[model samples]
Target: MTRKTILSAVGLVIASFAVLTALNYATAKRLYHSLTLFNESVIVENFSNMSDIFETVEIEKTAPEHKFGQAYQPLPKTYLYKGEKRDTENFLEKTSTTALVVIRNNDIMFENYYRGTTESDRRISWSTAKSFLSAIFGVAVAEGHIASLQDPVTQYVPELKGSGYDGVSIKNVLQMSSGVRFDEDYGRFNSDINRFGRTMALGGSFDDFAASLEKEREQGEYLHYVSIDTHVLGMVLRNATGREIADYFNEKLWSQIGAEDSALYIVDSYNEPMVLGGLNLRTRDYARFGKLFLDNGQWNGKQIIPAKWVTESTTPDAPHLKPGKRDSSDINLGYGYQWWIPENADQEFMAIGIYDQYIYVNQKAGVVIVKNSANINFMDNGFESATETVEVFRSIVATL
Candidate 1:
């Protein structure tokens, strides 16, 4: 109880924290150096294995439906990538594709698995999971839970009182134009995105980390890809609905969609769902999600998502998200509510993720393609890139 003893205890605690921080930094740097562990093997295990770093909330199983006619009919033999035509076989090999499934009008046109994966594997959706959250938001809006997309995020999530999101609207977050300063390079250990990952790994809170962000630009001024923006959106949605995300997902969309197996979401130490990219579902189930959007939020006979919400969600009306350079398409892209639009495309949008995961919806062709990969070199430019994967999806749809 002496003053000397109290000072000693405080110093010891500080020293322990410093040592743990140094160790975590070293581990992150070392892990980033290995492609096999950081990219390939970890991705394979992310689906089949996820207990060490995550606490999961189960998505209740859905009643199955005989929705698809048959699978693996035939696909385009060749596809063009980076201005060169290549065979489908080579493209899959080069991209490190783990699973590929093509669904045309509710019938499987092609399906295949590689890299020790099977049809039943509950693959992680990565950022592609953002679209799933977007879907739930749409239903929330229609039900009057979230008054409007134009509402500021802090209106519902008061915990973000004075952070970068203090003045950002839900629409800006959905469009990824929150103007928060964040570096998303997965290969960089010290980058903001990686630091966020480290926070989760070390039992830090996603919301607290997000609320700590500083403003990089005026709200809605730029179209930078800030993953934490989606987390804020999820935070608002959860607060408004007053339900666990997994339970709400089951009630509103998943259970009605006829998912063959239970889907899963990775939660943080506080048990809050990682709404930015924690969704894990089967390949066919991903296709079913795409079909829901294609149907304009209709499934079988029910309007699962609001028709108006569906239309507005895909339609990028904001000036920062229009299909033009001034609208931020120097990368040959525009963005929707939570979707991506290719340069000069007609009625086509996609859900994409890092480490090469996608749900490509070509509504014009009535086709949906779900491709998942563990490509460590996804950041590599030239032929093997996310853009080229879109090209491959386009080529396949063209052949159909």
Candidate 2:
């Protein structure tokens, strides 16, 4: 009687454990699916509408430039209502923004969220990730993993030999002048950039994806913006250090920069990071990165990146020519390494991303504006408005 009862009780315990496990699994799966649907339908869809609204507005005025750190001290609080309108409403009405951050003199001046974006949300950086990649390159160089910016990318990624990046120096790739015929038109579904995105999304190896491109012209002769250039940079960093880009970034920058929160790099199906545009982080953490650059790569009294490299990488000395030409009359906006230099009086530059992501750094005004958006269709329109908004913000800082 005792043996039979003991066996029966053991069987019942096992059965009960199995039932609990199955219930937990089902609950987790259901929650994940619901969150995914909300992200796509609510977050992404609302962002699309905001982008469309921004495209219709015409930015007619420019703001005056203020001296760096003069207007706000110890960071200005986020303006709840500039007038009768909420700040989020202004972005939805005037710009395609899911998140926006403004910092002056290493302090947060203004931070805002729109379309349900929040401080904890991790927004996509798009090509703004390129500038971040460039910073990693700087750290690699400083750490001696990469010999120099002048080193040819092929030296590390031998597979790129005879490809579009065959003779391209790391510096050329950083400047987006590798002379590869990469179509960056996001509106065209069949464009090369879109093809690359598809390849990334489909679990293709980034190295193989980049090697598939053919060289169209000599490196360093054109100012064409090629996203692959950054990929090549990532490849070089990987090969040179024999480490994953995410691991390298976490050790060399994120952890060292005292990032307030953990960030995730969106991974491909095979777990490879979409190094070109898949970085996601909090807005204030992004501000920390911008402030690192503003401080010449010094964080907590440590030289995180060589100050000289920061100076040269952002300085615009390279010859800017139209694509496929050695000479042109177009007054090209300045570009150095992966950073963009505005064409006006203020010496402000930015790390701009598709769909309105921006790391706008104004050295003269001591302001850094970091924004993230989902405007996959409106490129030129967004840029024009962002430029104007930056000028206006700079002007307001000056008045204060």
lDDT of each: 0.81, 0.67
lDDT of 2 by residue, 320-358 (tens): 732112362132456787887765537566777766677
Every model's TM-score: 0.88, 0.75
Q: Please give the distance, in angstroms, between residue 124's alpha carbon in candidate 2 and its true position after superposition.
A: 0.7
Q: Give candidate 2 misplaced runs (Cα > 4 Å).
A: 1-92, 321-332, 380-383
Q: Any idea how many clashes model 2 has?
A: 2
TM-score of 2: 0.75
Per-residue error (Å), model 2, residue 259: 1.4
Please give the lDDT score for candidate 2: 0.67
Query: Can you list the residue pairs that collide in candidate 1?
Result: none
